[model samples]
Target chain A: MTDAAAPTRPIILEAALDAPPDLVWRALTEPELMARWLGASDIEAKVGRCFTVRPDGPVGEAPIACEVLEAEPGRMLSYRWRATAPGEAAALDTVVTWVLEPTAEGGTRLRLVHDGFPVVLQGAIRGQGAGVSTMSAVRRRQAPDLRRRGDGRAKMSSGEVIKWAA
Target chain B: MDLFDFDEAILEADILRALADPTRRAVFEQLARREMSVSELKAGFSVSQPAISQHLAALRGAGLVAERREGRFAYYRAEPQGLAPLIDWIDRYRAFWPERIDRLKDVLKDIKP
Candidate 1:
């Protein structure tokens, strides 16, 4: 869902996956598959489906409330992302839209759009979350992609690389 | 990781609490554009004068606003740096998807049918 009053730009992270669209789509949709990659989430690939994501990492964070907004098999997946930090009343509401395209090499081109951040601190803050206003349109496409190492190990990113707000 | 996470979480909580109120968020949006005295802010908002002061105080406490005094008037404006915690959160957040997506690659390799 977008904020009609103020359409803030989204955080886009694009990647070219070695696998085809169908495989990529499955990983994004199936709960069992999603857990392996997207932390612990009960995500389903149906529009209006509600789910929760509790990212498992070094530090445990609050679970994020999510609802699927658009689910197109092998093509797109979009969801509403609402997060409440521990002890906070207001939820940081945002949207996440994933678009997948098939490449000439039979790989999948995936694009993720995360928007609906508060723009109160527009100029000074630089979009970061649904506080997410300055991470504004941080396009991290060209440098990142899924690749395979000679040892057959899967490498997902090219490491931390971004030049925000130049 | 744990050491810094605690501090960041607290800062993030403060900012979210400060802006959680729609009216206060509105107050912030107004002050962010330009500096204004409490009376000036009151003219645009339906909230009481005392309520405006309270909102300003909340914003100030969160470090989302800075106060200025001119003659007898006190003015407040948005503090850009107050959003640092969020920026930190976003950095962690932005990193989240990619790292997960990265793991997805491995999952796909194993389960590719």
Candidate 2:
């Protein structure tokens, strides 16, 4: 899992499913079924609407506030994911998109991408060593000092953050 | 590497180009807060009316912003649909986390107190 480095570009992941495209589409758009796998109590997939996704076991924070960016029945869906609570480093909300194509074997080729990594990752790779231009130095260097600082300013726990950074 | 595997890259490039300009970025920031017309966008910044129009044109071309003609004025707002593909792509990785946690739970269960 790489931090999507490009501000405008998206990080893509693909999966080929044995199920038909229609079946996959239902699994994606149908909120009740999607919750079984994806978690969250209320999910409205319409464009311009808001949805809440509460994943179990604390991956980041609970109940991320999401705004529907786009949706095309049976083909594509996109939305913005952002932390709902305040006092967390104000981050540029990230975007996620999914595209489904019909494969030759009557299955679906699912393509997913999330764009807008925080500038800190790019700074880290560039050897800036300091945090992102926007983030506090403590947060920017949290990976190297996870054991020392477990104050929990970030949505993801230290272990979770380290695993994600890896 | 299959460079052309994702056309959303092309879409992203276009969005980036639209955002390259300072005025356009400010325009987007304004729209993020609330829908506004071309005149309203002009008011938010110190640029000339024609300059704001040019920025709006660029944003509209990128599909990052959409316009609707209401009476004599044109209203513009954030095109949330345009951003959907990017957001959904990121969430795909979230699926892997639970499995990893489950594995760690198993390891802990195996350990003696």
Candidate 3:
């Protein structure tokens, strides 16, 4: 069984944009607009729609594969992103969620959460170690640890602090 | 080999893949408390003895755990240093997001109403 005490910690980023929620949403969801600000992407704002984001440079031309998980116009958006380098059989999958709240001053308060990384890693490790059958239980147990580790305060069974190496 | 010469992406991927299992994580955490032999570790989990050995092998492969034989029995302990690459990878995003947001702000300004 998974540990209940630890929860997956998402990478959160917040920004207050001097624009309305609809404007901010369009910038984030529109491929042309997103390419100008974020990266070159052909993403649509519909749940289950798959897309890709190809950024220019030495990072190679392998695009980031994405699938929209949630899409609420002018409010919230979430998607699963996977990056697979050429010649590698395995891909790193992560989830990115965006929450937009309209401010009293008419600006947009944007919060972004990138999650599922640690669990993905943990699932791979567990499958290799214990076999694939136990992955769900292991993932449930690992969620809390991922969340706890994100905040930089991971605790062991003995209550000893497990500090991340700098 | 110089540590700086290590390919971080490859190393980080390998490390993450190795420690991704819950059983291995528990084993690593158990070892973090104190070094233990295979039989001793087996007592803490409901899995078969062979399963524990498999978990240990993965942990060792990732360099997250180390083994030392004392006579017939081999004891394993957590090697915290092995986690450095994963931590570094996470830290990069922590630093990268703010700067990206600033760039986004500039992008927003250029957009017409």
* Candidate 1: segments with Cα more than 4 A from true spot: A1-7, A123-166, B1-51, B67-77
lDDT tens digits, residues A84-161, model 1? 656654346678888999999998988877776555455333432333332232222211332324443333355523
Q: What is the TM-score of chain A, computed separately for every candidate? A: 0.69, 0.64, 0.65
* Per-candidate chain B TM: 0.85, 0.69, 0.83
**Residue lDDT tens for model 1, B1-113:** 22125455566667776876778878887776678999999999998999999999999999988998989888898765676566544445555666767777789789876
Candidate with the greatest DockQ versus the true structure: 1
lDDT per residue (tens digit) for residues A41-140 in model 3: 9999999999998654454335778999999999999998766545542334568888999999989988877765453234234425433333334333
What lDDT does candidate 3 reach at residue A36? 73
DockQ values, each candidate: 0.31, 0.03, 0.12
- CA error at residue A103 for candidate 3, angstroms: 2.3
Question: Each model's fnat?
Answer: 0.28, 0.01, 0.11
lDDT of 2 by residue, B18-58 (tens): 66555576676566556798888887799998998898888
What are the per-residue Cα lDDT tens digits for candidate 3 across B1-113? Answer: 11111255556556666665667777877776668999999999999999999999988987878999989889998766666555544444444455556667777888846
Per-residue lDDT tens digits of candidate 2, residues A51-134?
876655433443556788999877888988653234332233567677889999876776666665432123222433222231
Q: Of models 1 and 3, which has the larger lDDT?
A: 1
Residue pair clashes in candidate 1: A117-A130, A118-A130, A126-A134, A127-A133, A127-A134, A127-A135, A128-A132, A128-A134, A129-A132
